[model samples]
Structures are given as structure tokens and as C-alpha cells.
Target: MAVAGVSANRLELLTIADAVAREKNIDKEIVVEAIEEAIQKGAKSRYGAHHDIRAKIDIKSGEMALTRHVTVVADDWQPEDELEEFNDSAMVRLTDASKRDPEAFVGKEYIENLPPFEFGRVQTQMARQVVTGKVRDAERANQYEEFKDRVGEIVNGTVKRVEYGNTVVDLGRGEGIMRRNDSIPREVFNIGDRIRTYIYDVRAEAKGPQVMLSRSHPGFMAKLFAQEVPEVYDGVIEIRAAARDAGSRAKMAVLSNDSSIDPVGACVGMRGSRVQAVVAELQGEKIDIIQWNADEPTFIVNALAPAEVSKVVLDEEADRVEVVVPDEQLSLAIGRRGQNVRLASQLTGWQIDIITESQDSERRQREFSERTALFQEALDVDEVIAQLLVTEGFATVEDLAFVEPYEISDIEGFDEDTAEELQARARDFLDRQAAILDAKRVELGVQDEVMAVPGVTGAIAVALGEGGIKTVEDLADLATDEIRGGYEVKNGERTKVPGVLEAFNLAQEEAEMLILQARVAAGWIDASELPQPPEPEYEEELAEGEYDADAVFAAAPEGDEGEVVDDEVPAGDPDQPENA
Candidate 1:
């Protein structure tokens, strides 16, 4: 396109702008504005750089106008910023301008028409830069608007180039980048090669809007399955959960709202045609399509498929589960480098442990022996009787000590006298153990008030003192995570934080209760203000002459006259799987 003074026809300018707009895929009005800016820049360079030069172009007839404007300002006009010097060429004082023009006032502009001039060598270069910069900005804006809301959708593109393990993709109208970690393992892409990627993120930066693409995102597999399986796209069968190990392996849990359809079979298709399509696109990544069950344990069993599970032990409070399989199936259940169990854990939202049946049996035997030993030492019984008590589900000495006399007497070959004798021995053992732990707590400088908190046991008091929580105030200040354990980021890595009562195996709710009770004991809160838990089912009062260990050896402050609650410690369930 020729300049204003080059005798270029009026319609010729609009034709050039229209062509540029179509080629750049931007609006024609943006092109016209950019050209007007370019002309204004050139006029400034030819006239005075300080003058306020303006340019306008009529889009229809392509009529051009050039004008210079000087605005009247206050006599004491100040520049916009400290470093900006006042320009008299663009601004004139009202008092001075009023002498030349009788009606001149502040903010009034004196306008003059300027004849169009040919562009010089430097002006032409400056105009080119102005127009190019404006057009580039408009293109970036258009690109950002087009792709900003397209994240999580799949898109097709051509590989523009690969630099430093990052693939740059030309997404037709915009460019996207897939970082090394976001690409499938060992996958390669060459320049100009056709590719399909998931739009995972779109970020606006100073340079441009970045369309972050990925082939390894778990959502990519879900989208692939949606495209391959009609039921998934129509929401007849839902993809409940998905986990991927990039190009190596993946697991997907599907659920069918309609009882007539089998979710797994539908995903598998006839002879696995549907899943095969997804697998081929993922570079032959193995896909396990498991039917999801509403019951978590059942779902977890399905998640660890192909390896028959002998048993599943769930610790609901810990969000952990242990799966026992036959010895020969251990390797298959764990997969290569533990990938199978890891993906299962991710898919089920549970921390999974894979164990052989023999290993589980050994662990159970160990726990049995340990409990048998405890009963013998606490009740002064022989191995036969100790084993009998363990076999009957008596774990802690406290349980045997505090249980109703009838519960112990009902055992075979046991009479009232034998039950009474066992009760005496169990209570004596608890009294001795409590005294020992209380002495140790004192030696560790634990305050008596720390033991007075509801739910605090003698052993728990000692544990707290050893963990530097020696006072009720100290315990009151703690968050539940401090007592139940959690993770923290340190040195740019996640590190496990050991809880103060980690060894007690306290549940999250138990930890919260302990802290809240401590807060009341510390005078930080009122006991009445605490959340009241549902009362436990009432049991009949123990026989009048029965030794009450709870009343005698319960930990308490010197002056505390309040009731003492039972141990916060887990009431060891003898039947529980040892490794659980």
C-alpha cells in the first residue's frame, strides 16, 4: 500500500487492510486502527515529535485526514509524572493562548489541518514497526480469546517443532506447548507431524497466552474413551475414576446407572474394540476397565483385578486397606515396580498394601503370640489359659480387668471363684502399670494438670511429656494434625511430620477430642462449650466388691474432682488382621 502523498487511490488503502486482516485472521476494524496509528506515528516524525498529531481513515471510501492539535492548559500546568518534562509544543497555557485567541480556555484544543507528506527513510521504518506491533498485539488477544475457555477439551494440531524435550504444536490458529513431563513416556513427535493433545491449561503471560497441551493427562484417556464409546459420551455409563502411569499403564473405574448395561463390558466393547482404540492412541498403554461398586472395599477388590484377593482388611479411619493374595499372585498384584497396586490406590482413593496370604498368616500368629504373652504376664496365668483368653478375644489387660465378672466367668472350665481371681490379678497389674507411667511422666517434668484432661491416660501423659507437650496449655495449642500426624513441605519436598501421640494409633476424631478437652482444662475454653459426643451404651454396674481399676488408678490432677474417662488408646481388637 502506498503512503498518503504517493497518489494511492482511497479504495486501495481499504483493500490492503482487508487483505491483511483476512490473512492474520483478525477483524478488519483492528487493521484499520493499526494503519491509522502507523500514519499518526509517521506524521509525528515529520512534524514535531512533541506535537499531538492525529490520523483517521474512513473504511468505506478510505478517506484520510491528518491534523495537529495543541491543548490549552492552566498557567501552572504540571507534567503527569515526576520525570516527564512539560511539552509546550503539544500544550499551551490558557493565559498565553487567550492573547492570540480571545475565547481560549483551559482544556480547549487549537486544531490545524496539515498537508500530507511523503514518508522519509526513518519515518517509513518507524511506521512499519508501529503497525507491526499493533497487529501482533491484536493477534495475541485473538489467540487468547479463542483458546482460554477450551481447557480440558481435546484438540488436533501439527507439531511445529521440538526444543529441549518440549513439543511446540501449531493448533491451527494458535500455538501450544507440551512440556517433557506432560508428554507420554518415550514418545516422540517430529516437525509437521499430525498430533492430538489435551488442552490442560491456558496461561496469559507477558509474552503471550500459552496453551499448555498434554498427551499424558488422565483426562486425555477419558476423552479418548468418550470418543470411542458412545455410552460414555451420552453419560449412560460414567467414568467414575481414572488413574494413569502415562504410556505404561492405566486403570479406569466405570459405573452404569442403568442396571441392564454392564459398564465394564460396554467399555471393553466386542472383543475389546473400544478400549483398543484408546490404547493405540496412548502408545499401547494397557488399560484396565473395572466395574465400580458402591461399596469401597468391593470397588478396591475390583481395582486390583487379575490377581484373586484372599481377603481385604480396611482401616476406614486411616483411609488405608490391606489386600491379601496367594503367594504366587504377589508379583502380579504388585505389577512392575509396584505400578498395579499404586494405580489401584489412586483409582480407589485408598492407600493400598499388597501382601501374600502366608505373610498375613505369619503376622496374625505374631499378634496372637504377643497378646498371649501380655495376658500371661498380667493375669499370672499359664500359656494354656493365656492362649484361651486371647482366643476368646481378650486383648489388653484393661479389657480383662474392667469387663463384667460374668463375661470372664462364662468361659468354659471357669467358675465364679476363677473369674474373681482373674479380676483381682488384672486390676493389680493395671494399678502397678499406671503408677509406673505416672512416675515416668513426673520425671519427664509433665505437669499434673496435663493428666487431668478428659481422655488422657497415664501412658498418654508420659507420651506427651516425652514429645515436649508437658502442660495442658501446650496440648491445648495443638492442631489435630499435630497429634494425628500429617505432611509438610520442607526444602521444596514433602516431609512426613511425626505426631506427638503417633504411637498411640489415635484416630483423627480422637485427636481432635483430646485437644479440645485439653483446651477446656487449660481454661482457654469452657467445658460446656465443647461438642458433646453421643453417650455410649450403658452397661450394668460392676459387682459391689469388684476392684474398680478405673476409679482407683485413673490419671488426674492433684485437686481435680471431676470424672475420669477411660483410655483414649485403641481397644485392641484381637480379631483384626495384624498387618492391617
Candidate 2:
């Protein structure tokens, strides 16, 4: 150890540096850096700025000292409390001031000594505060030792505490924080819970080191498998990929290095002991062990298990699948609320739509029927006009006896000018055959299908027509309760009036008239808008041959199979009654 006469205790600085380096486990250079900074601060405080002062330290010898630069003066001034300009006015021989002349003069140059210091109580207190901070900084560096190289490694720790939804784990030498987002959902940890997680990342900070842990990382499952399977450790099996719905389900794709030793079997021990261990660690989260495949269809089939797929129509460009199965298997293949297909889609990164046999057939049949009906209906109005005209004996223009311009105009394709020309030429010929034709009323005899109701009248028919409620189709389209609310009947002391046309009272004739008008407006009685009449299911009869096709054909009659001639009317006649 070394000592100083008027400045420093030489051994003290060396001893302090050695102590800081050893206790904080840091390099001596760091402590030296701290000491150099401290001395510069102390020197500035002890010496005023008027003096140009400097300091040096010898770590090996543990010695420290200070020196001051002074300038000589020619005026009656000493190098004590005055500015350097006053000293500049003095002139003394520099060589004499260097030798300490007894009679010193102005304008001379020399150097003076500033003694080394042993820090006073105030300075020592400040130095100690700085040393404490520096040591903590050094310790922070040491704290990162275990975490810096351990990122992405598996670690287990006891839960120290929970704060602000973050779990703090005691990792023996240090603590790590498992943020709420980093934890698997629906999973909770207690104070003493022994939690296993992957080291996600590490960061060095001023206070200490921070290690981030995660349980939701997909790699955590893969790492856990490696720990349980020896083949995975020795490179005989590989985990191809893993997809997880954390805390609920996970699918892991694995393949074998040697095809003979099944990769899935190796990961799942003889009785599933290996995977069971992993499942227990994961708090009963289900694991699907899938065999990896280069062929996507086979992989998808494995991903969706227990539900057999009848066919898979893959759309490679869109990365989707249309899976079809038997009608009875639809619910099973779709699983409870489609959970099975959803998980399979997540695992395979594909969109899947599941369909049943009946649904597929119905879809195709609807398309075919619509296409055919559209083709036939496009130009078939001529047939309907021909049949109606034939019943009226408007079979030929000459049969009319006296052709009217309006009668010719009534024909759909005949123009007005053509009708006028034909009527003028054919009047006499048309009039001659008019008496031989049948009565117009007898030609069209279709009647109203509904029974007449009492108290109801044509007032309701006029109201229904004006209100756009003209038909059974319109009435059936409304809910029963909605229609019922529209009707009003007198109750006790109040006179009631119908809010809707459906509730009006009418006589039988009026009801018949209403029904006839409604049918004409709606185009049907039990309208198409009503619930469809169930088709006759002749499946059993047809299968059992209850009726022979040959006998049905033999029983059918022929020969005009027609009605009488009493109802025939003249051609181009306009007075025929309308029928439905």
C-alpha cells in the first residue's frame, strides 16, 4: 500500500476498486471507469475555476495527486486570489520564479502544487452514492448471464406472484414475467403453481434482466414432444408442423425418418403413455396425432377422423374443398355444430364445405327443371289462344256469318287494319252461320269452388280488391294471427267494425261473388302461395306392383272421348262467357 502527504490515501482507491469488481462480479476496468469519474468531480469541487487544475491516479501504487497552473505577474500582485490578467501585468524572470526567487516580481511564470486529498465527509458521501449506483449497474450485467443464452429454451419455475394479470415466476436465480397475453386462455396459475413454459425472449435493463415466458407458443408443444420421445431426440422422427387452438385442441404433424418405424406410433407410445404425459402437462388439452404426408387429400382425411368422407372435390386454385357424404352421415361428418370440419380446416389451411347426397341431388334437379321450363314457356301463348278460340266455334273466319272488326282484333296476332279489312269482306258469310251455333253461356260453365257464407256481402269484395288483398294467395302470405287481428266482432257493450276485409259479413250470393273475384285476381283458390300440397308418395305402391301398367293402359278410353255439340258457338264470336 502507498500513502500521500497532502492529497490521497493511496491504498484506499485500489482497495475500493478491487472490492467493487469482486462483490459485483464485474471487470476491474468498470470500477476504474467509476473512480476516474468520481475524482474528476471531486477535484472540480475542491479547487476553484480560477486555477487551472488537473489530477492523476496510479492504480498499481494506489497514489493520487493534483497540480495547479499559475502565471507570473509584474504588478504588485501574488498568484493567489486575482485573475490571470493581473498576473499578466507582472514581469519577473521566469528562470528565477522556477527557482523560487525570494523577491518575486510581476510578469513571471511558474507552477504551484495542489496537494492530494482524502475526501471529507461531504465528498465521501457523494462518492459512496456514485459507487453504489455503479455496482448496481455491474450487477445488472451479471443478472443477464443466465437469460442471455437461454432464449427459446424450455424452463420450469414456481409462480411467485400475480400482478395486473401478469404471472411472475421464480426461476431460482431470477424472476421472469409471464404476461397475460403470453399465457394460454382459460388457464390460471396460483401462487405456488409449478409452471412450465418456453423462454420467449430476454431483455437487459437498468434495474435488472427481464425474461419473457410463453405457454401459447406452438413450438412449446413440439419441444415437449421431443423431451418425451427418444426417437425425436436421436433424429429418427421429426415434427413436421404444429397447429394449436391453445387450451382446447392441437394438431401435430409428424413423419418418420425410416418408414418402418411409424412416426406417430413413436411419439405415441405403446399405450399412448408418451402423448398422455404431454396431455397431462397441458392440463387435458386434446392432441391430434396426424401422420405427415406430401399428399394433401390423405393428410386432410387423417385430420378429419371418425367421419368417413364419400368424396373430396378439391379446388386447387382456390385452396378449398367440397366434401360429400351419404345423407345419413351428414350430421356426423359435420360434427356437433361443424366443430370437426372447422378443426380440420384450421389444421389443413383450407376452406371446407360439407354436403349430403340428397342436398346435392336436389340442387342439380332444381337447376335442370328451371332450364327446361324456361325453354318451353318462352313462346307458348299461341297454344292457349288456339284452344280458347276453338271452343267458341271461331274455327274459321267465314263461319262468323258477319265478321266484326273487334272479333278479328281479338285474335292475338291479328292487327287492327287487317281486322277492319277482313270484317268488311266477310259480314254476309258470317251472319248466315250465326243462328246454327250454341249459346255462349253454355259454352263456358265453370263455377265458384267455395260455399256461400251468410251475412257477408259484396262490400267485402270491393274492400278486399281496393286494399290489394284480392286472393287466397294474398291472404295465405300473411300470418294467421295478422289476419285474425284484422277481423272484429261485437263484444258486450261495444259495437265492432272490421279492421281488414277478411272479417266483413256478407250474404251467400255476395260471398260467392267475392270468392269468384278473389280467384280471378289471385289466379288460384288454394294458391301456390299456400303451403304446397304433399306430392302423392307412390313409392310403396310402385315397388309392390299394386297396379299393373298394362291393365291401366287397357282401361283408358278413346274416341274424341268428347262432350256434346249443344254448346258450340260461332267463329270469331266475342260474347262467349269466361271460364277458369
Full-model lDDT, candidate 2: 0.61
Please provide, for model 2 over 46-95, each residue's C-alpha lDDT reduced to its tens digit, 9 standing for 90 to 100: 66544555555676886555655565544344456555344222244455
lDDT of 2 at 446: 16
Per-candidate clash tally: 0, 32
Query: lDDT per model, in order?
Result: 0.85, 0.61
Candidate 1 residue lDDT tens string, 327-373: 99999889899999999999999898888979988998999999999
Q: Give the distance in Å from residue 416's predicted Cα in candidate 1 to where it truly belongs.
A: 9.2
Give per-residue lDDT, candidate 2, residue 442: 20
Reference-based TM-score, model 1:
0.73
